[model samples]
Target: MKNEIKGCIKALGKLIFSLDDVLNEAVEFPKEHFQPCANLKTNLKLFAAALQKIDGKYMARKDECRRLMAQEEVALAKCLCHFRAGNFSMDLLQKAVTLAAVYGTRRQAKEMKREAQKIAFQYDLRSQNKNLVTDSKAKWEIMEQLMADIAHNINPADYQPEEQIAWEQILDSFEEKLREKNLDLKGMDYNSEIEELFTSAREAVVPLKLAEKLKEVAVERTKKQKTLLETLERGRE
Candidate 1:
C-alpha cells in the first residue's frame, strides 16, 4: 500500500508542476505543444505516497489529483489554457460559468485540490513512522492494482455514457412498437417510458452478477416493506 501510495503521489506532483507552469506562463507557453486534459488525468494517477497502521490495520491512499491551475473541466479547462483570463473576455467568462455548473468553478476546484494536498500531507506524516511493515500483503495488492490500471486504462469515455445508450435503445424499442401498432408518436413521453422500462426491467441489459444482486435486492425490499406494513396495521389497531 505504501509503495503504491508513493507512485500515485509522484504522478500527481508531476501533473501539478506541469499544469502550474502552463498557468503561470500562459503567454510564453505553446498551446499546440501541451496537452492539458491528457496530462491532468494521466498524471493524477501519480503523487507522493505514505502509509500508517490504524487500529492494527495498514491504510494507504494517494493524494487526490490537483489540476486547478491548468486542468479545466474539458472545454472550459481548455479555454483557460488557450486564452488569457487577464483579457477579461466576457465570452470566455460566460463559457467558464456555463461549464462550471457541471465541472465546478475554478475557485472551487482550487480549494478541493488544496484540501486534498493537506490530507496527503497527513498521510505522509503517518508514513514517516518506522513501525509500518514493508513486506505486507496489502502493499503488494495495491501495487498489482496500480500496474494493472496503468496497463489497461480503459476509461468510461471509451464508449458512450450508459444512460445515453439506454435512452437510444428505449427510443428504438418505442419506434418499433409505434410502427407495429400504427400509432401516432405525438402523445408519447420518452422520459416516462424510459422510467417504466427501468421499473419493469427484470430482463434489463446487465451482467449476470448485477442481475442476481438486483433480484436479491428486490426480495429483501419486498420482505422489509411487508414487515413495515404489518407493523403499521398493528399500530392502527
Candidate 2:
C-alpha cells in the first residue's frame, strides 16, 4: 500500500507537470481558454468523481482527499472568467496539504499547513492583481512563488536522512527546470490520479455498486456545471 501510494503521487506529479506545460504554452491562447468551458468542466467533473471513488475506497486518509477535492472545485470556479488566465494556481496548495497530512509525519504536516497558508495569500494576491494590486506585485509574483514553493515541500518527516536529502535535491532540480522554462506550476493538484487509485483498489473489476455511485456523482456535478455556465452567460447578457 505504501509503495502504491508513492507511485500514485509521482504519477500525479507528472500529470500536473504536463498540465502546467500546456498552460505555459499559452503564448497565444487566452489564459483561461485553453479548453472550452464545457470540455474543461466535463473533464474536471470526471476527475472529481474519480477522486470521490478512491476516497470512498481508501478509508485511510480519505478525509484529506475529500478536502482536496473540495479545494479543486474552488479553483475551477475561476474558469468562469474565460478571458483571464491561470485559474488553477491553488492546486498545489491543496495537493500539498493532502500529501502531507496523509503521508508525512507531524512536522511535515505542519510545514505543509504553512505552505497552504502562503498559497492562500498568493491566491489573494492573484485576485487583487486582477483588479486591485499595483504594479509592484502582479500575477507574476504568484507564479514565481509557486515555482519556488514546490521545492520547499517538507519531505515526509519519517524519511531517513539520506532519503530526505535526496528528495529535497529532486524537488530543487524539478523547480529549477520549471524556472528555466518560465512555467507556472499551476496544476499540481490534479485529481486524475484517483482513476489509477480506483483501478488499483479493484484487482477484480470495479464493484458494481461503487461504479454506480461514482456515475451518479459525475452526473450531478455535470448538471451543476451546466447551471453555472448558464448563470454566467446570463450575467454577461
Candidate 3:
C-alpha cells in the first residue's frame, strides 16, 4: 500500500509539471497573427476556466503544485488578452513557434509553425513591392525619431508657441503648394521621382509638428515603442 501511494504521488507530480509546461507555452503564444479577436477572447476565457477546474480537481491531491499551475494558467490567459488587444504585432509568430516547440503538444506546435510560415509568406509579398516598403519604412522611421526627440524634451527655444503656430501655417502653405503642383502623396508611385519629392516634402514638415506637440503630453512615441516591442516579443516567443 505504501509503495502504491508513492507511485500515485509521483504520477501526479509529473502530470502537474506537464500542465505547467503547457501553461507557460500558452502564455508565450504569439499575439500578432492570432490577435485576440472576439473568437479568441472567448477561447481564452474558456481555456482559463478549464484550467481553474483542473486546479480545483488537483487541490487536495497536490496543493502546492496546483497553486503554481493555477498561477501559470492565469498568467497565460492574461498574455492572450494582451496579444488580442493589439499589444503585439503579427511579427511574433516566429517566437511563438519556438516557445511552442519547447512545451506544446504536437498539434499546438504544428499550428504555431503553420502560422509562422503564413506570416513569412505575407512578409515576402510585402517585400516584392520593395520601393513602397522602403519608402513607407523610411517615413515611419523619421516620424518615430521626431516623436522620440519631442518626448525627450530636446526641442530648441525657437520651437516655442508662437513659432509652432507659424510652423503650422507654413505646413498649410506647403500643402497648398503640393495641391497646386497636382501632387498627391498617397496616390503617387513609390518608384517615381514625384513620390520621392513628396516624401521629402513630408520629411520637411516633421520638425514643425514635433515643435508644436512638444509642449503637450503625447503618448504616441511610447505607444509606438510598446507596440513594436510587443510585436517583436510575440514573434520571438
Candidate 4:
C-alpha cells in the first residue's frame, strides 16, 4: 500500500511538472490569443512540491492514512482555487478537476466529476475562445490516458480513507469490552479490570491531549460537507 500510494503521488508530481513545462512552452510559443496566467506556473510548482512531500508511509496506520489523505485533498483544493481565481484556460481547469477526482474520496470524486461536466457544458455554450477550446480538446485524450495509467497503479481504498469515526462504533466496542470483562456498568463491581477497561475506552474515544485535535477535525469535516453541499446546490441551480 505504501509503495502504491507513493507511486501514485510520484505520477501526479510528474504530471504537474509536465503541465508546468507545457505552460512554459506556451509562453515562448509566440501565441497572441492564449497567454497563461502569471502565477499559473508558480501555483503548479507549489502544488507539485506539496504532492512530493506527502508521507506515503502514513498508510501503515488508519489514523495516519486519514490525516495524510486530508492533507493531500487540501493541497489539491488550494491549487484548484488558485486556478479558478486567475484567468486560466479551460484545459487547466479540467486538469485540476481531474487531479482532484483522482486523489479525493468517493464523494469528492463525484463532486469533481460534476464540476468537470459543468465545464464541458459551458465550453459547449460559449462561441468565443475556440482556440482555447480546441487546445483543451487536443489535450483531453492524452490527459485521460495518463490519468488511466496512474489510476491503475493505485488502490481506490487508499484514496477513500474512513474520514470520521462514529460515536456508535466506539460505544459498541465499549459495550463488547464490558461484556467480556463481565462487568455491568450499573452494578457495584468497581474492580481494577473494570477500571482498566474504562481507561482503555476513554483513550480510544478521546485522549486527554487529543481532544482539541479531534474537535478541530470535526469542525473541519463539517465545513467541508457544508461547502460540498453548497457546490452541489449551485450546480443544480
- TM-score for all predictions? 0.24, 0.21, 0.29, 0.25
Q: For candidate 1, give the lDDT of residue 12.
A: 40
TM-score rank, highest first? 3, 4, 1, 2
User: What are the per-residue Cα lDDT tens digits for candidate 3 across 68-96?
Assistant: 33333433333333334322333344445
The digit string of per-residue lDDT tens for model 2 on 1-237 reads 444444444433443445453233211212232233323223333333333333333333322122333333223222222212333334445654654444334555576577457646765734644432222232233323322222112211111122111222333454455466575344433233422332333313335574466457547656854654454345435
Per-residue lDDT of model 4, residues 144-175, tens digit only? 22222222223222553233323333445655
Which stretches of model 3 miss by more than 4 angstroms? 1-51, 57-60, 89-104, 116-237
Model 3: clashing residue pairs? 32-89, 36-84, 89-231, 92-234, 92-235, 95-235, 95-236, 95-237, 96-237
Global Cα RMSD, each model = 21.6, 20.3, 16.0, 21.5
Off by over 4 Å in 2: 1-73, 76-198, 202-206
lDDT of 3 at 26: 40
Error of 2 at 224 (Å): 2.0
- TM-score winner among the candidates? 3
How does each model score on lDDT?
Answer: 0.33, 0.36, 0.42, 0.43
Q: Comparing 3 and 4 by TM-score, which wins?
A: 3
Model 4 clash pairs?
none
Provide the clashing-pair count of each candidate structure. 14, 0, 9, 0
The stretch of ten residues in a row with the least summed lDDT in candidate 2 is 155-164
lDDT of 3 at 76: 37
Worst 10 residues of 3 by lDDT: 151-160
- Model 2: residue 53 alpha-carbon error in angstroms: 21
lDDT score of residue 196 within candidate 3: 51
User: Which 10-residue window of candidate 4 scores lowest in summed lDDT?
Assistant: 25-34
